[model samples]
Target chain A: MKSLEQYTRFIEEKIAGINLEEEPRKLYDPLRYFLSLGGKRMRPILTLISGELFQISNEESLSAALTIELFHNFSLIHDDIMDEAPVRRGKPTVHIKWNSSVAILSGDVLFVEGYQQLAKYTDKRLPILLKRFNETAIEVCQGQQLDMDFESRDDVTEEAYIEMIRLKTSVLLGCALEFGAILGNQSEETRNHLYHFGVSLGIAFQIQDDILDLYGDPELFGKQVGGDILSNKKTLLFLKAKAISEASKDARFGDLLQMAPTDSKIASAKKLFEEIDAKNASLETMNGYYSEAINSLDQLESKGLELGSLRELANFLITRKL
Target chain B: MKSLEQYTRFIEEKIAGINLEEEPRKLYDPLRYFLSLGGKRMRPILTLISGELFQISNEESLSAALTIELFHNFSLIHDDIMDEAPVRRGKPTVHIKWNSSVAILSGDVLFVEGYQQLAKYTDKRLPILLKRFNETAIEVCQGQQLDMDFESRDDVTEEAYIEMIRLKTSVLLGCALEFGAILGNQSEETRNHLYHFGVSLGIAFQIQDDILDLYGDPELFGKQVGGDILSNKKTLLFLKAKAISEASKDARFGDLLQMAPTDSKIASAKKLFEEIDAKNASLETMNGYYSEAINSLDQLESKGLELGSLRELANFLITRKL
Candidate 1:
């Protein structure tokens, strides 16, 4: 089986080959442009990795991989528009590059294209795959909605915040793995195990992202650290800090919230988070999910499906630097 | 076979029965509110009608019918947001009712819900049905893009406008019909005929809508007469008038465009459209599509499937009061 890196390169070539109708340049140009600003392509690669674990060839699983990637981009386009975000991956977002209308319609076309790609799978599992895909699509939208809703409300609980992140970020990763397993013709029970493996990894990865926003190595992380705190985003780290402050009556944490977003604010918030043990608490939770991910892999290994690649990938996610 | 009225009532009931996630009220509420502002359930009815012609029972075809309805509403919500349309069917548009983000995400969830409804089809035809749905969905986006593109350009030709409407408005009607036909186990040749029947009917219906905005019974139509003209919309009728004016260098028509949109301008524009035979020209085009629609129905009839209901529906669309 090809390594995860090889699968990612293969997926890159496949994405480069995607053809969209050229006439409505306004409708399709944004899609082409957005896809051109490539990210890690982690989600699609996961589909391939799961397929490898299930002994499905990359060719047989490529459609689902592409579908996941296309759907991911579609969500980003619409989500960016919703957030009124200006840039994605250091470039103008689709909405900013063209207009919101173009973003909405192009994102929509990309969504339909994802479904079209999935329809290429002419297997007995197509219906089940379609069913799971539709469910995950709706869940992702709900996740985005919950995330947005959390931003405006002060009543967002720690549990609710985790659920939002799960819906928003993690479910699609789980879905990618599940689709791969389904296409490999694995039993539903086996697919569920692999799916949980993905879900746990995604949750851990997201927590790491939250932690890194305040604690990442400046030279290595590439982005401005503490950007989340500066933006007042209700990330898991912030929620954890709030939970600890409320339990301990920590007035210093409340004062940190009142500070204007500045370099000093970032440094002070970082120090406060560490002192209240909020950072430590978040790290514990992240490790919990990380351990849960490994436990899922162990379950898969017990079933005699070799998971060396998936195991390495999980480890990379946990130990990832940037 | 159920009468069109009975089928409409059935669809109305099904629409009312739709359930969405309750926790994220922000996401699902807009969907519920938009669907509540009911219009003629024309598209879904076509799905059931096509099913009946192919001897697929209404009960069996309800899922496809509901799928079409949900998809139609999904497109409407997103299109309204794109157009910044303030109202739909005399109620606030989803964007206006909630906000653009809510509308975008809610519309997305509704689109996913449409696919879930479609997945209820357990037959071998599900894959083909999904393929057509995705194709039509993409075409609709392209059509909307072209329509928006036409809004800012002076170079939009009459031919391009028709193709835009065909993509934006006609293809889904065709798809709704085609989906039903496929579910009924019809041959590809037979389904194409039924699909073309819907397409031709949709095109003719849209042209009639253009004519009605200028000349419909104000009391019956329930909208201000010549609203399209006053709004400076480059509808088919205006495009036809422009084409005529360009050919003849009719200075009066050119002056009419520069005139402020008022009661006097509407009257003069209506008179000019008649005097220059633009209205007559559009009527001929409409009739051409109407005849094409009938010819498709005739082909379906030649296959020994009864076309009474579909034929009546087409005639109703062509000669309806409003």
Candidate 2:
């Protein structure tokens, strides 16, 4: 049973030693540069913890965790190029640091490395593991396509958003947990429960992120709070804000939002938000998903898997402000 | 056995059915457009012919061939972005038609779908097939990196250029053949031989392309001849020219070369190339690799594999002026 810090530290340590930096620098230097700019790395930790829930960690399970992390980072690098993102984890993104073409090619190499890492597990489970991984990879891409589509649409509903996020974000988490469970020789029934736990938690995490985008304290959030609201991005908060407000009340709100959320607009939008109770509405939705996440964990507990450490991890995640 | 034209026609027919015009049109449309702006379909045809050699053909093989072609086109789209090239086959590139970011993301989705199509293979050979495919994918990225690096170096040798082309260009062809052979359930030894056949042929094919770039008749080639020469690109021709030229006579050659490969430089370079017998040098190198390719086919024939059709395919490839 690893503590949250312990799992986080393990990921950092493991990835550090997976040195991809030497000569052939052309092929691997960008990989090293990009992976070093870390995220929460929750996917890989879910893998490690899920494997630990079943039994002692082995080379097979560890490699699977590393493989998923590599794949996850690979997606991020490419996604940054697509999104024209300048920063990742408060650091210059790979594309920003080098160039988009280099980032594109490096991400391709990272994906190939992920597959190579998975191929190291040439055992009885190889076919199943590879097949599942390949399918999940496709799903991730579908999710990304949906996200891109959502960008251009004004009609994105909450349901579409949830499904989009699930495809783009949740499936990988679920796959990470399920892959680890499979490598640990968990029963199919147990793997299914683990997957549910990961997916439910992923949805909750995204919802929380949406709420935070408007309501988060900038000191703690590490990003521009209310940026999404400024863009009129159809996050949960904006969707709920649009939903909860009446047509008669739209006049004052329309005036404030029409300015676009700059310094002046920020104060104005916050005033309208308070008047309409958008933060509270967003929080209520976030709590709903958070409770659903907890309910899934409870369901997992009923299946007789060790729940103490997992519950703690879940608590740490759901309770976090960032 | 399916002739190369039959396989090419099969790919053309398959690709013809794909609807490139759809909503959220940015992602899939480029793939459709690129596929429609056709090339020789050489790699996919190789995949199919290898499959035919192993007695594997059907709708599944057709889908697999389409996958290879789609994947190849996907790479070309991204490569055009990387190279900032405006045209492909004298038509505008996807990035040129749309934008760079769209081209990047669209190519990614295409790569993802390529795997999805390959996953349609119900054969037990998928795991090994995908493993080899992933390796080749990485080599392609590495090859691109080497190509980029070669641009910065003044001393790029003939060996380095050939190796880069082999990895970036030839390996994919080899992977295509190997993928088809694996799906056909051919013997491992036979699959290895076919892979070598593809690799050798790829090398010969690329060398032929270098020759065509400088010397092919413009009408047949469908583009300006000597475009590579104009760019001062470190092609096999340039390397050979550098190698065969007298040191004192060609001493100022290095400084005169420019990035854009202008009309003035092109004429001068061509003059110097013939002066030092670089055309002969390049042709000799091309012939050497072509012989190696034919030797690889001979080895396959020696193993009692029916190679008559393959030899015809090779002849057709070698005889192409464009």
Compared with the true structure, all predictions reach lDDT values of: 0.89, 0.77
Candidate 1 reaches a DockQ of: 0.85
All candidates: TM-score: 0.98, 0.91
Residue B157 accuracy (lDDT) in model 2: 80
Regions of candidate 1 where Cα sits further than 4 Å from its true position: A1-3
Across A1-322, the per-residue lDDT of candidate 2 in tens digits comes to 6567777778888888885647458567888887887777788888888777778473447778887899889889888887889988888888888888789888877877787777776665666676677778766776777888788887888788888888788888888988877887777877777787778778878888877676678887778877876777778766666666644456665565578558777666667776788777767766776677677778778877777877887787777674
For each predicted model, how many residue pairs clash, with residues at least 3 apart or on different chains?
0, 1
- Write out the backbone clash pairs for model 2: B230-B261
lDDT of 2 by residue, B187-269 (tens): 88878878887888888888888878877887997678887877677888888877665455567466546435677776677
In candidate 1 the C-alpha lDDT for residue A168 amounts to 88
